[model samples]
Target: MKLEHVSKTIRHKVLFDDISFQIHKGLYRLTGKNGSGKSTLIRLLSGLSAFDNEKRLKLEGDVLFLDLNPIGLAPFSIKDNFYLLCKTYQVKLTPELEANVEAFFSDSYNDDYLHASVGTKLKLGLSLLLVKEWDYIFIDETLSTIDNDSLKIVAKQLVKLSKTSTIIYVFHNLSCLLLEQNSRILHIEGGKVREV
Candidate 1:
């Protein structure tokens, strides 16, 4: 996917101005200071929010965006939530998906939705979404809530998955996981985006 001549403005303050960038199929790490428009750029690139683009965004494939918010129905069983997500995205419950979820939830963790922590909920949501074949997967600070072990596991899994899907992991402060994954860096600052 390519974002050409992209710009965003809110409340009379310019967030980004006429920035052009291309998103390829690989792992990417997005970094910036607080309120630097990292999420805004993701929203624009992933078609979550409108851009002051004049229709300049050219998306090449279906995008799956997972932010800090745990995806799925809040008032449902874990199984039911997974099922609903799969149905919404038109994906099957493949073994890869099962493995992905298992990486986060051990054989011992409670399967109940209410009992699951934010990390577990996000993990389940991510696993269900990641199973699908998407052109780009933009994860914005969702993994930060997970415990260290699970984060490491998910990071490794994300690295593996990046070979097939374009994964964009965003953070306010850069993490070592990105370096370990050898992810390309996209930094947002001064109302501009640049590859570093």
Candidate 2:
């Protein structure tokens, strides 16, 4: 994916100007200070925002935008949500695979369905993403909520994704993960993006 001459303005001020970058096939971390418009850029690229003025967001091929708010609610049960997600992505989960989802999220705090808590819901969403195929995946600061074991699973999944899909993640915790430092880092300050 390449964003060429992309600019976003709000309230008569440009948040970012001519922000251009290309993400090759690999895991690239979008690192910058808070309020740098990182989230804005992610949302724009994900086609969830109309904030860009230049409208130069270009995607080469298939892209799966997985933000922190993974699954949208429809007043459905956990099983229904999981099945819907699978159907939307055209993925087939076997009976054993479905059982593991229940097993993975079961806890005393959670009900037998594992849909009682927000944490469990997030877990379900993460689990759903593991088996899907895509060309690119964008994750915006959602990994921090995962527990230790889940974090390990996420890291391994990301590494596996690097082989096929380009993974662009906006992360604050750069200490625990492995990524290429040569990747672009945009520093947002005072409503402007400066290459760092």
Candidate 3:
């Protein structure tokens, strides 16, 4: 994907301006201070928000964006949520996909996703997202609330997924997960983006 001269304005305040970059398949870390437009940038990249100059944006392949809270359909069971998401995405839930979801949650299939533990919910959401094919995946501080064990599982899955998908993750701190080798880190500050 390539973004040229991208800019965003919120409530008459400029968040970023003329930001441009080309991203390839790999792991990327986006870090910056609170209110520094990290989430805004992710939104723009994922097409959740429109850029000032849409013509300057060049995207390739399918894109998936997972926000800080990815636990969808809280009142429903994991099975139900999975079904709903797959339905929304127009994905056919085959037997193999069902088995994968069951394996992801293990014994939590019967429990309400909203009531599940934080780690369990995170694991379930991450596992569910992995079922679909995505060329670019943007996660905005979603894994920060998971436990160490669950974090490890999610990290391993992300590493595996990175082989075929471009992952752009926004983290407030780098100590949360051990990043993969050669992962690029970009810093956003003062409405400017610079590789750090």
Best by lDDT: 3
Arrange candidates by lDDT, descending.
Answer: 3, 1, 2
Candidate ordering by TM-score (highest first): 1, 3, 2
Writing each residue's lDDT as its tens digit, candidate 2 over 18-65 gives 666655687667766776678887778666676566454556665677
User: Better model by lDDT, 1 or 2?
Assistant: 1
Worst-scoring 10-residue span by lDDT in model 3 = 173-182
Stretches of candidate 3 above 4 Å error? 53-60, 90-97, 180-182
Model 2 residue 134 lDDT?
A: 69
| Model 2 misplacement above 4 A | 54-62, 70-76, 95-115, 178-196
Among all windows of ten consecutive residues in candidate 2, which has the lowest summed lDDT? 106-115
lDDT of 2 at 132: 68
lDDT of 3 by residue, 82-136 (tens): 7777777777678887886676677887789888876666665576565776788
TM-score, per-candidate, Cα-based = 0.85, 0.77, 0.82
Question: lDDT by residue for model 1 over 100-189, one digit each (tens)?
Answer: 665557752337777777777887656654466777788888877766776777677677778888888785554555444578888888
TM-score of candidate 2 relative to the true fold: 0.77
Clashes found in each candidate (C-alpha, N, C closer than 3 A): 0, 0, 0
RMSD of each: 2.5, 3.6, 2.7
Residue 58, model 3: lDDT of: 45
Give the lDDT of residue 6 in candidate 1: 70
